[model samples]
Target chain A: MSFDTELAEAQSAIGDGFDRLFAATPDLPLHRAMRHAVSGGKRLRGFLVVAGARLHGAEDALNPALAIEAIHAYSLVHDDLPAMDDDDVRRGQPTLHRAFDEATAILAGDALQTLGFELCLAPGCHPDAAVRADLAFSLARASGADGMVLGQALDIAAESAADPLDLDGITRLQAGKTGALIGWAAEAGPRLAGADIAPMRAYAQALGLAFQITDDLLDHEGDAGEMGKAVGKDAGAGKATFVSLLGADGARARASQLVDEACDALAPYGKEAASLIAAARFAISRRS
Target chain B: MSFDTELAEAQSAIGDGFDRLFAATPDLPLHRAMRHAVSGGKRLRGFLVVAGARLHGAEDALNPALAIEAIHAYSLVHDDLPAMDDDDVRRGQPTLHRAFDEATAILAGDALQTLGFELCLAPGCHPDAAVRADLAFSLARASGADGMVLGQALDIAAESAADPLDLDGITRLQAGKTGALIGWAAEAGPRLAGADIAPMRAYAQALGLAFQITDDLLDHEGDAGEMGKAVGKDAGAGKATFVSLLGADGARARASQLVDEACDALAPYGKEAASLIAAARFAISRRS
Candidate 1:
């Protein structure tokens, strides 16, 4: 099947899984806010998980995919709080704090984060308890101080810095802020199958950087309506981004090169990684 | 050893554990905030984990004990946010948000929550991977909705309710808000040993309720100087609490009965539970 078709299928399955999980929760306003926060996303991370799992022999990828999406959703909800990025809209919908009150938003984000760990640890996510623990541990590193949170903290601190981050600095920050989770999602298959992670890690590292560069490219030129949220936000804030450091044309060229590297890293899987290669190409080409 | 001495050892061990974990992180302002948030607490939850684990012959309880404390600390930092409880003081010191900025406070809480799961999944927490997964899963449920979060959400909603929560309603909320984590801590020993949870569950149920009643008693009548945070806030806000519902005398009587039941539940363990019995009594008798 085409990568687009596979991605859509993955998104549908993951959405259904989330629905099933959240349906049993009490209909309190906080719960409602949580449901709303997870309601919309491209589910690219979920697709990465499911597709990566398929590359291996894993059949039950729903739980890990769900866990990754929950983590992503919680990050977005917290990042959009008034104290953080303060964005009022996300994925074309009102942000959680705007839709619900700030306290509910904060608590919902906290609960959603716990839910991610719970889903990973819950039975059916993995047959071996060792794999489950590994998954949870990996996710914690990707999302915690040494990764995404550190990146965010740096980003916030950078805003008032006397010197703007250069290319290397921006790359490092984006690696943590955006690349870490993507890298984790891409390695899910190997982790679950108890296979060597080197090849998958290589593929993910390249793919993650490529994804962020393309994201910067899109933000530089994409229309706000098409992007679902405000575009050119980084440039407007005078923030250092790939496009700003490399120029739009140079950024595009770099993303293309990284995509090639990503595809090459998957050669160990031979022809079976075709869809993943397509995903790499699509990463740079998509509008959103 | 006396329960006080044992509790002190647990506190010191947990404190050192936290210090070691945070010491390696980059000393960014945000990291400093996180360290501060976990610095001071009675470490009551940690004591429960160690004491409970000791009862079941589980060694190396430090990791899970640290995990529980991290979860507890994160909840406190968020609960004291301006948008939440809006308190400026905690444990006789400035609250996290007051000590650091709001953004740092939010990020610190987020990272601390993630750190809890990481510590639980880390090796040395348990000998078996299955046990680790179980620990993570249980902590999630206790910390997430259907437990603490659910209770918090209900409490927020109750503030604007036309009718105040009755005695039963207040009991249910307190059980979720405060009792969930305590119950989980108390059950850690049985869970680690793969033993029956019924006895520990009963003990925790009684102990948790008794703890809350005493807390209510303290909130209603304790001095602000000793309590650290404001006292009589619940009554000032017209919120329903055990003391408000049962009155101080009745609440004390109920707490005394609960202590008895908690002790009785430990009869299965006989003299091995002496320190736990002392801890139970201390739960109701302590001034702060």
Candidate 2:
């Protein structure tokens, strides 16, 4: 399928999956919190998972894509909590806690985190229990203490530090918090699809770094309305950013170079990986 | 080994595991929340898991036992959130969010939940990847939406109902929320130990119900100081309880009956199941 067609189909699947997920939970406070946190965004991570899975020969099973996206969504919900980013709004709507209560928001995040794994292990996604287990292990590693949680901890610590952190420190921090999960998504699809994972892992790493660098640049230059969050909040907090360290032009160059590296890593898979390559480029170029 | 020796050993292991868990995330707010919520528990759930594994003829592995307890601890922390029970105290200390900020507590709970699975998948637990995967899958199923989350949703819905709930209603609610995970602990050991699960599952179910019945009875008859948070809170909220339907004496009777059933379920396992039998009895007899 063409990239546009594939993207269109994935979007439809996500919409349907989300509708069922919401229906399953109904209008409870935690359910509402989940809906609020998941309402908008490009679904880039979902697209990447789908694209990677297709490249690696996964069939029409959209469960893997949905599960990966759910984890991404859950992370954003917790990341925007009052104790983390403390944002009152997300994707142009009041954040989960703001819409409900802080406690509800917390539970919603917890539910979604677990739900992601549940979706993966739901009855018939894979015949081999080991695959489901691997998916669970990978997701936990990406989102837990050594990965996203560590990144969040570092982000909290960075917010209060007076000294300027070096580029490596900032990179390592973002790699854990943001990059780790994205990379996991990319790698997960291929693993489940029975593809050789070496190239996919490399591509995912570059794509993840490129995605974050672009996000940093967008925060520096993008419109708040377009981004669904205040653009200058990072600067306001006086935290380190790629754009801050490397300058806007330098950051853009770095992002583009990373995208090129990401694409290069997919060469072994040929045309099957075209959507993934387009996704890497899109990650760096998208307004949001 | 006697229950006391096993209990002491499990407690020491839990103490060390918790020390490492807290130290790993030393952000002051997060650490405080962990300390506040994680301390004061008797680690009964951890002991149950160890005993269950031992009953299945596997030597105690501290990592798996600690992982099970971590899930138990994380659930308590989230369950006490304002949107849920709205309690300010647990085990006589301020709840996680009460001791720290709401956001910190939320993140701490999230991290802890993920940490449980992470600990299970950590290096050196089981050499077989399939066994490790089974552990993750079982844990996720027990704790995720279809299990605990569904029960919690039901509890929230039940709280606002005009009519008093019956014994069945209360039992179903607790079975999912509290019983599912407790049941998971019992079966997890056998699953991990690669032993037959049929007997373990039966024992877990009976023990889980027995524990809830005793809890309801305690809420009616126990002291607030001995029970930790306010006693009779359930009655005050007009939520259903076994005691509400069966009366205090009846609830106690049911608990004893269930304890007998739990013990009977373990009959085929012989002396190997002694600690599990004792733990089931202790679940009903404990003050806290």
lDDT of 2 at B107: 66
lDDT by residue (tens digit), candidate 2, B1-288: 877788888888878877876776645565556556667678877787777777666775666777777777788887877666778878887778787766666667777788778767665667666677677667777887667776776677676678866777778888888888888777867877788888888888998898888888888888978877868888887777888888888888888998999999989988877778888878998888
- Candidate 1 recovers a fraction of native contacts equal to 0.83
Q: Assess each prediction's global lDDT (C-alpha) against the native.
A: 0.90, 0.77
A226-274: candidate 1 lDDT, tens digit per residue: 8888788889999988888889999999999999999999999999988
Which has the greatest DockQ? 1
Interface RMSD, every prediction, one decimal place: 0.7, 2.6
Docking class of 1: high
Interface DockQ of each model: 0.86, 0.48
C-alpha TM-score for every candidate = 0.98, 0.90
